[model samples]
Target: MTDLPHYTEYDTRLAAYAVIRDDDGRVLLALWNEGDQPRWTLPGGGVELAETVEEGAVREVLEETGYDVRLDGLLGVDSFVFSPAQRSNGSERPLKAVRVVFAATVTGGELTPEVGGTTDEARWFPLDEVRGLPRVSLVDVALGYLAAG
Candidate 1:
C-alpha cells in the first residue's frame, strides 16, 4: 500500500482537463481516483508535450472515463498546493497541481472504465448534486462555467 503509482505529485506537477457535459440539465461526475484525496471528480489528466489543451481534454476524457469528449468551452484554471495526503504514488511530498476546466459535449463514446481507473464508479449527477459533494471545487467551477454559456 505504501508503494503505489500516484498520478500527481508536488515535484512532478501535472495539468488536468475537467470534461463537462449537459444532459437534460445535468452533468457527468466521475468518482475519479485522485490518490489520497479519493473523491468524485471530473475526468481529466496531465497535458502531453506538444498536445494542445483541447487535445489533452479529449484524450484525458477518453483515457480516464472511456468517454470521447468534444470540448465546447474552457471553464477556468485552478492551482492547488500539494498536501501530504494528496500524494497518490505513496511518496512523501506535496503535489502542486494545475487543472484546466472545460465544458465539453459527448459527441460519441461509451460509458466504460479505464484499465485500473482511479475511479471505482462513474455516473451522471445533477448540478445540485455536484454542488453538494464534499471534495475539490472543480465541479462547482465547471457548473459555473457551463451556466455562463
Candidate 2:
C-alpha cells in the first residue's frame, strides 16, 4: 500500500497507459500490489515533465511488464476525481486524473514482473476473462475504447 498514490497537495496529473494485445487477443496487464489488495490494470503511470504521453506509455509498459511495444494510435482518454488517502486538510480535496490510453503492439521483450515497483506481476489475460478479474476502472475503460472501435 505504500506505493499507492498519496496526495499531500492538490494538483492535476496527466498519465498515459498502454493497451497491448497479442495475436490471440489477450491483453497485457500489470498486477498493482500497492493497494489493499492487488488489482489488474493497464500498464501505465504518470507522464514525466518533458516526456510525451506516448513515450510515457512506452516507458511505463517497459518498466511494469518488461515489454517493448510500438504505439498504434491514441485510443481514448479517461478522467475521474478522487481524494488521496493522505491529505493535509480534513476537507475532501479531490485530485483530477486525466489518463491517455494508446493502442499498442508488443515489439519485443519477455513477460516479467517489475521489481521494486508499484506492479508486482504481469500477465496476458484473454479478453473474455478480464471481466472476472479484480481490476481498476482504467482496465474497463481502455478495453471499452477497443470494443467501440
Scored by TM-score, the top model is: 2
Clashing pairs in 1: 6-88, 6-89, 9-95, 10-95, 82-95
- Residue runs of model 2 more than 4 Å from their true location after superposition: 1-9, 85-92
Compose the digit string of candidate 2's lDDT tens values, residues 64-93: 999999999999998977675543335456
Residue 128, model 2: Cα distance from true site in angstroms: 0.8
Residue 74, model 2: Cα distance from true site in angstroms: 0.5
C-alpha TM-score for every candidate: 0.76, 0.87
Give the C-alpha miss distance for residue 138 in model 2, angstroms: 0.6
Q: Output the TM-score of candidate 1.
A: 0.76
lDDT of each: 0.71, 0.89
lDDT of 1 by residue, 44-129 (tens): 77889888877887888887666777776767887776566656676677666777887788877888876776666667777677
Best by lDDT: 2
* Model 1 lDDT on a 0 to 1 scale: 0.71
